[model samples]
Target: MKHLFLTALLAVAMPAWADAVDTLKRFVQEVRSGQAAFTQTVTSPDGAKKRVTQGRFEFARPGRFRFEYDKPFEQLIVADGQKVWLYDPDLHQVTVRAMDQALGATPAALLAGGSLEKDFRLAPAEASDGLQWVEAVPRDKDSQFRTVRVGFRDQALAALEILDNFGQKSVLQFSQVQSNVAVPAERFRFTPPAGADVLEQ
Candidate 1:
């Protein structure tokens, strides 16, 4: 759980420009569920290397997602609509928080039924790497990220670049994104392991 709040916020982004808005609406209506493999690189705002984590993710819309970290550490974050459970296997600890508190104005809430115009000040960015990009700055003063960029390839979500307040950036690139796929119900259901410490925030 390197950056728990920050990780929860890497959900989505969109700008009000015609093309960007169209892309967001199309995704909201069609790409309701997905699973993908990801490579995430975290760097200092000054371009210094922090760490890299690779993992697979499975998510369902309207507020359900799970992240499984497999490299550099083993951890998991699961949201069962109402609550979010973060498990740090190496520490034998689990942290739980209500969905509203955990997601705030993060990208997770955006993809899970939030509207860009309502929650973020979206700005269109010049297209790059065959993807249309939008920068999102949260309307909430207390958001975990300073700004986030969402990239879409042909209206399909491709990656997220998150800049935390302290000048650290984490980039998550998704590949093998399968939409409308079946993800087992139990994926978002978490039970703390025996002897693990549980902290409720």
Candidate 2:
């Protein structure tokens, strides 16, 4: 009787594991655009130091997004399909890189739409903190991130936990998520302020 009960338990638990990866696939395929407020906490490799930042993000499919950091510092990152622009208001500088060179195998690529199976080795991760998790290991050997875990709550994107090559961990918790909304086209456009230094890579 005990063996039979164990088998039944295993059958029930197995589907939950697949749910995480399935949720991610559905999210990537169905949600074309989204905007959300996020809190990002980054921890040092030794866990002795930490930094927190708050931001608002908006993204459209096929390579367009904007991340505007508001607290602690004012910075903006915009991907305009062709180039990725990083602007530092305090430093009065703008940096630009080709989008293809900047986003390959990164979290932005995952969320901004791509060939997921080609870029990542996807697997179901153990559920934690009341969220189902999917772990994505980038197939690009030269990628900066070691692993990226996306967490979903009730089939909605809840959080992203990224572990980098240097052992640093960054966790982004999203709130006020609005999925499949029409984001303004201007959100992905960036222009350097007059007199600000611009560097292109």
- Best model number under lDDT: 2
How big is the positional error of residue 179 in model 1, measured in Å on the Cα after superposition?
Answer: 0.7
Per-residue CA lDDT of model 2 for 33-152, tens digit only, reads: 999999999999999999999999999998999999999999999999999999999999999999989988899888887678888888777789999888888988898999999988
TM-score of each: 0.87, 0.93
Write one digit per residue (lDDT tens) for candidate 1, span 8-78: 12334323234654576677668788889889999987886789999988888878999899998998999
Scored by CA lDDT, what does every candidate get? 0.78, 0.87
For each of the candidates, give the backbone clash count.
3, 0
Q: Which residue pairs clash in candidate 1?
A: 11-107, 11-108, 12-107
Badly placed stretches (over 4 Å) of model 2 are 1-12
Q: Tell me how far the alpha carbon of residue 112 in candidate 1 is from the true structure, in angstroms, after superposition.
A: 3.5
